[model samples]
Target: MHLANAPSARRFTGKSNRQARTLAATLVMLLGLSQLAPSVHAQEGLAGSVKRGGVIRYGHFQEPACLFGGWVQQWYLQRQYSDNLVARNEDGKILPWLAESWTISDDKKVYTFEIKPNVKFTDGSALDAQAIADNINGWLSNDPDLRNPTAAPYLGESFESARAIAPLRLEVKLKVPFQPLLNVFAQSSQGILSPSALKRGLAVNCENPVGSGPFIVDKWHHGREVTFRRNPEYNSAPATARHQGPAYVDGISWKFLPDQTVRYGSLIAGETDAIYDIPAVAWKDANFRFPVLRHLTGDPPLRLALYTARPPFDDVLVRRAFAYSTDRKAAVDTSFLGSLPSRATVR
Candidate 1:
C-alpha cells in the first residue's frame, strides 16, 4: 500500500551493498510516511466525519466481458458484483467470506464449509449449501455442454466433486491433497454464483448476473461504462474487509478509458475519483495531485515463453545468454519509473 517515493529518482549504479540497503530502507520509510501523513489528515479532517451516499466514479483501462465473475480472469469489474467464498487480508492470511467457517479433514482431501445462514442473492434467492456446491462443482463438470471453458482453466485438474450434505453445509472432496485449495477459493473467478442464474445458462447469466455482494449491477452501457448500486441487504462483508458495514459510497460508476492521457485528464478534471494503470511518465505530473499506489512485488505480470523442446531454446547456453542479455534493471526503471521493488526476483 506504499505510495511512490520522490527520492528514488536517482539511477542505481551497482554501488556498495551497505549503501544500497540504506537507500532502500529510506525509500520505504518515506513512501509509507507519505501515505500515512495524508491518512492522518483525512481522518481528522471534515471529509472523514461526513455522512456517506456519494457515488464513486472510477476509471479503468478496460471493461469486463460480462457480469459473471467466476469465468473471467482479468475481469476486474466483476468483483464489485460478486463475492468470493474466502478472502485474503493485507497480511496474506485467508479469511471467511460467503462461508463463515470451514474445516479440513486430517487427510486434507475433504473440505467442509459452513455457509453463512440467511444470506440472499440480489434476486431475493437464498444462498444455501446447494448453490455453493453448484457454483464450484460446475467448474469440474466434464459434460461438454455444462462445462464452463473460462472457469475450467482456473480449477485444479484433480478436482473430484462438490456437494451439499445439509442446508448450510457443503463438502468438497478432492482426488488429491490440494494445499492451495483455500487460495483458489479466494480468487475472484471462484466467486459464488446464484444457482437460479446458473440454471438459465451462461449467456443469460453473464448478461444479467445476481450475487449477494455489496453491490448489484444497475446498468451496463456496452463498451462505455457499467453502473453499480449498493445492495441495502448486503450485510456480509468478508472478515478481512476494512469495515463491517456496506460500502461507504452510495454506488460506483465505472468508466472505461483505455487512453492513459484521457484517463489522467479525467482524474485531473475531477470527473473520476480514482484511475488505474497510470503511466510511468505521468508520475511526475501526478505527484502534484493524486497519490500513486503500485504493486510491491517483484513478480512480472507477464512472461515470454521459450520452448525448451525446440531447437534454439533447447540449448542451455543460449537460454542462459538470452536471460543475461536482458537489461531487467533498466526495463524496470524505465517502465515503472524506478518504483519496482528492488528485492523482486526477475524470472
Candidate 2:
C-alpha cells in the first residue's frame, strides 16, 4: 500500500511549545531517513544517528509463526510482503491496488476487475488474469469438502464463480448482492500469488516468497532474521506517495529478538533503527529521547476469539460467571498499565 505521507507527517502539536519542538525535531529525523536514504543502502539514519546496516529486531509474544498457518499474524506478514487486489484504509474504506478499478453488475452479483497492465511477480512470471484465477483456485483447494472453503466466510454471501475474461480482466459471479465484497477482496488471505510459486508448495514458498509488494523476501533464517529487498519489478509507483520509484530503504532486516529489555536497549544504544511492540514502561524513556509510535486499540475494540464450541466454554452460565467474577480492571492495571479502557460486554 502507498502511504500518502510518511508516519511523521501526522504529528499533533500542543499548547506546550517544548513538546512541539521535540516532536518537530523527531519528525525531521524521520523525514531525513525517508528521503536521503538511498534505495540500495542497507543502513538508514534515524533519530539523528547513523545506525549500522543490520536487522530491526522484533520480539513477538508468541512462538515462531507458521508462514501458512491460516492465522491473523501470518496473514498480516503475508500482506506486508505481498499485494492484494484491493487495499483498506485506516477508516475501513476500500482502495484499489493491483486491480486498478472494478465495476459491479446492476444485480450486484457480477463483479469485473480491470487489472493493471505490465505487472510482474518477483520470479519474472507474468501476473495476468489467469494467474489471479490460479491463486484463488489454490486457496479454494485447502478444504476437503468445500469447493472454496478458504473464501467461504468472505465470498459466501455473493460468490458463485470466478473466471478470467481476458488478459487484463477478470469477472466473478455472485449468489447475491454483497455490498462489502470489495472489502473482502482487500483482506490479506485474498492476496494474489504467482502460479509457479504455489506449485512449489506453500511451506517452501513461505521461506522464499515472491510478491509484487514494495519489498520482496530475500532470506529467512528460521529463528534469526528475515531479510527483504525492494522489488525492482514493482509498478505501483502511481498509487504511492513516493512516485519516483521503489521504497527509500534499499533493504530491511527483521531480527527475531525475543527479549524486550534487550530490544529496547538496542534501540536506545543505536544498535537497531526501530522496534515494534514496545512495552508500556519503555514508552516514558522513548517519549523523552526517541520517536515512539504507540498503537492504542480503538473501538470495535479488537476482538478476541474464544473456543465456544468446546466443553469448558460451552456452558452459558459458566461463561457468564467467569465474566462476572473476572477482575478486568486489576488485570488491565497490572498488565496494560490501565492504558486500555474498559468495555461492557454481554454474555
Candidate 3:
C-alpha cells in the first residue's frame, strides 16, 4: 500500500484521492490512522486505539441503482457485505479467501479451486461448489433478471463452464487462456453473494443480496443512506483482511452526500466518521488538521473518449487537435489544488 504521509490534526481530519481503486485507499477514517480492522490497529500499536463496536458514519458521493451494481461506487458498498474468491494484499500478492487455494491446468484454461470448508452464508445455507457455479453461470441463464452484471463480462467470454466435482471443490474451465483471471477474481465486483438471496428476484435481491462477509446490508433508504449491521456469523475473512473475525465496527451508516463541500463540512462538524474524498481546494487546510491519505489512481488513469465513428472526431486531424487543445494539467491543478498525480497520457 503506497500510503500518503500523515500530518497531525486536532479532530475529524480527512484526506482525498483520485479514482480510488481499493477500499483501503478510499476508506480513510476521520478517527485518524487506519481502523478498518483489528489487525491494522495491531500493526499501528493500539495504545491510542478507538474503542470497537461503534457504527461508522461514512459519507459517500454517489449512490448505486441497486446495492449490487457495475459502478465503482456500488462495488464500494458491496465490499462491506461480500467476500471474493481471492484477495490482493498491499504487496500485490494473491491471497486466499473463499477459495482456499487453486491450481491452473497446464494449458492455463482450467482452474480448480479448493473451497474453504465449513463456510456458510449469513442465511445459514452452505456455500458449496454448486452455489459458486450458480453465480458464474448467471450470465447464461434464460432469465435476464438473474444475470450478474459484475461477473458476466469475465465469465461470458472464453468461459466454458463452472461446476462442482464435489461439494467443496469448484472446477472452472475457459476456452482461452487469461493469465490475469486471478487478478480479476480479486476485484470488488467479483465479490461473491449468497445464491439464496438471488432466488428472491432483483427487486428484493437488490436491497438484500446476502453474502458470507463481515457486514450485512440492513436497508437502503433510497437516495438518503444505507444501513449495515455486523454479521455475527461471518468467518470468511480474506487473507489480506485486517482482522480475522467480524468487522471491528458494529455497523456502518453509509450516507450519500454528493456535494464535496457538504461532505467535508460533515467531517469538520463531527457529523461523520469519514468522508469519501476531500475537496481539492481544502487539501492544504485538511493536511494541517488531519492525517490525510491520498490514493493516486493513475496507473490506469482516467481516459477521454472521442467517438470517431462519425462527426469531427472521425477525422484524425480533428482528433489530434482536440486531444492537444485542452490544458488538462492547468485545469486539474487549479481544480484539485495541485493534489493529483502529474503523469498523464494525452493520446
Against the reference, the lDDT scores of all candidates come to 0.62, 0.54, 0.69
Worst 10 residues of 1 by lDDT: 29-38
lDDT: which is higher, 1 or 2? Answer: 1
Against the hidden reference, what TM-scores do the models get?
0.77, 0.71, 0.83
Residue by residue across 215-260, what tens digits does model 2's lDDT show? 6878877877767765655675323222325544455555666787
Residue 24 accuracy (lDDT) in model 2: 25
Q: Which number leads on lDDT?
A: 3
Q: Write the per-residue lDDT of candidate 3 for residues 1-347, one digit (tens) a residue.
A: 11121221222234232211122312532222222453444324322343456676778888888888566777777787777788776566888989999999999999999999888888888888888888777755557667756666766677888899899999989989887788877877777777887888888888788888777889889988999888887788877666677666678788999998999898777677567777878888878655555654323444446788898778898877866776666655565565665444466
Clashing residue pairs in candidate 2 (N, C-alpha, C atoms within 3 angstroms) = 39-250, 158-175
Q: Which TM-score value belongs to model 1?
A: 0.77
Rate residue 42 of model 1 by lDDT: 28
Ranking by TM-score: 3, 1, 2
Rate residue 271 of model 3 by lDDT.
Answer: 77
If candidate 3 were superposed on the true structure by all CA atoms, what would the RMSD be?
6.4
Clashing pairs in 1: none
Which parts of model 1 have CA positions greater than 4 angstroms off?
1-47, 69-74, 142-151, 154-156, 297-327, 342-347
